[model samples]
Target: MSMMVNSPLYPDDVDILAGALYAWCAERSIKLQSQEGLFAANVAISLYDAGYHTQDQLLGALHNYEFH
Candidate 1:
């Protein structure tokens, strides 16, 4: 038997996203539920959807993004 899901990301892709989000928040002391944290999450997801699927690629893009 097999199961099908309708999502573009895989488990490892989620892991990289979580790890990058954690590292970014930890470095800046940003709460996971805070506004900036939400922004970071959005940016991460956007970058991932834009083909920044690798850990290094996502992290680098996240770091490069300014929080204005």
Candidate 2:
């Protein structure tokens, strides 16, 4: 599956990363629930905490998701 960054859903302070991740998941028809979102959120947070905010950075840093 291919991964790409997306725009923020809500306001500027909302979970921009989650929104991007969700968009990526949707593009691949990958369903994500609270649990899945949490996992991705964790990964997103990790990348953000590391001072990385690009979609490529997030996709590069995460490796546990099964994309079809």
Candidate 3:
């Protein structure tokens, strides 16, 4: 398993991060439950706290998610 720091969903700013995560969840057709949204929000906050600062940085973390 990869660490969260290595996860591609990490975001630079809170809004964009949330947008990316929201879109990801939406693509999966995940229902926007309060609990789930809260969890995603927390993850975004943690990523921000960890010093991620660009879309490329976040995308690099997401490398594992890419389809070959």
Candidate 4:
């Protein structure tokens, strides 16, 4: 399932990453509301593009990620 997200830079495969992020967050009980989902999707896409291709990597990134 593809999640609808609004972001500035969406790559061709962003939806795939976003869906993975949605599932990842869901598994962790993270609440990514409608508005916040856009940012979460963006972060997910960035991580995916950066070569962190697994949920565990994303989970670790989320733990160490600092919002600027």
Candidate 5:
């Protein structure tokens, strides 16, 4: 499942977040419908909400996240 774009984010932000989510999941071979995938989505959104706006920032934070 894709992350739901929140009202505060612009289209570019959405693109960055989505791409980050995709890369994060892809690296771990995680299905978006699974528990881990859900966690990843949540984490990505949370990070974005917290100010990791760029793809590199988001992905770096995500990669460092201990998702399991």
Candidate 6:
């Protein structure tokens, strides 16, 4: 899912990714508050867009619960 940066609807992408991540987490028995999970997903996406082009970067973002 691609989100248009700097657009009014950009924040909506956070919700979209959050929902997907939330479901994935739930399936894995990971308990994440809605806001926390959403922020984590958003940070992952941001790090990706920032040219952190590696699996490690993605994993780090997801595992870094202090992001929010």
Ranking by lDDT: 5, 1, 4, 2, 6, 3
- For TM-score, the strongest prediction is 1
**Candidate 1 local distance difference test against the native:** 0.82
Top candidate (lDDT): 5
Q: Which digits, one per residue and each the tens of the lDDT, describe model 6 over residues 26-52?
A: 655656666655555566566556654
- How do the predictions measure up, each by TM-score? 0.81, 0.47, 0.47, 0.51, 0.80, 0.42
Q: How high is the CA lDDT of each candidate model? A: 0.82, 0.56, 0.51, 0.61, 0.84, 0.54
Candidate 4's residue-wise lDDT over 15-34, tens digit each?
55665777756765767774
> Which lDDT value does model 4 have at 3?
40
Candidate 5 lDDT = 0.84
Please report, as a residue range, the 10-residue window in candidate 4 with the lowest summed lDDT: 1-10
Clashing residue pairs found in predicted model 3? 8-61, 8-62
CA shift of 11, model 6, Å: 21
Query: How many angstroms is residue 21 displaced in model 3 relative to the true structure, after the best TM-score fit?
Result: 2.1
Across residues 1-68, which tens digit of lDDT does each residue of candidate 2 receive?
11333443344424556656777567656666655665666566656556556666665555444522
After best superposition, candidate 1 residue 14: deviation in angstroms?
0.8
Query: How many residue-pair clashes does candidate 2 contain?
Result: 0
lDDT of 2 at 42: 58
Cα displacement (angstroms), candidate 2, residue 5, comes to 20
Which parts of model 2 have CA positions greater than 4 angstroms off?
Answer: 1-16, 27-29, 64-68
Q: Tell me how candidate 6 scores on lDDT.
A: 0.54
Winner on lDDT between 1 and 2 is 1
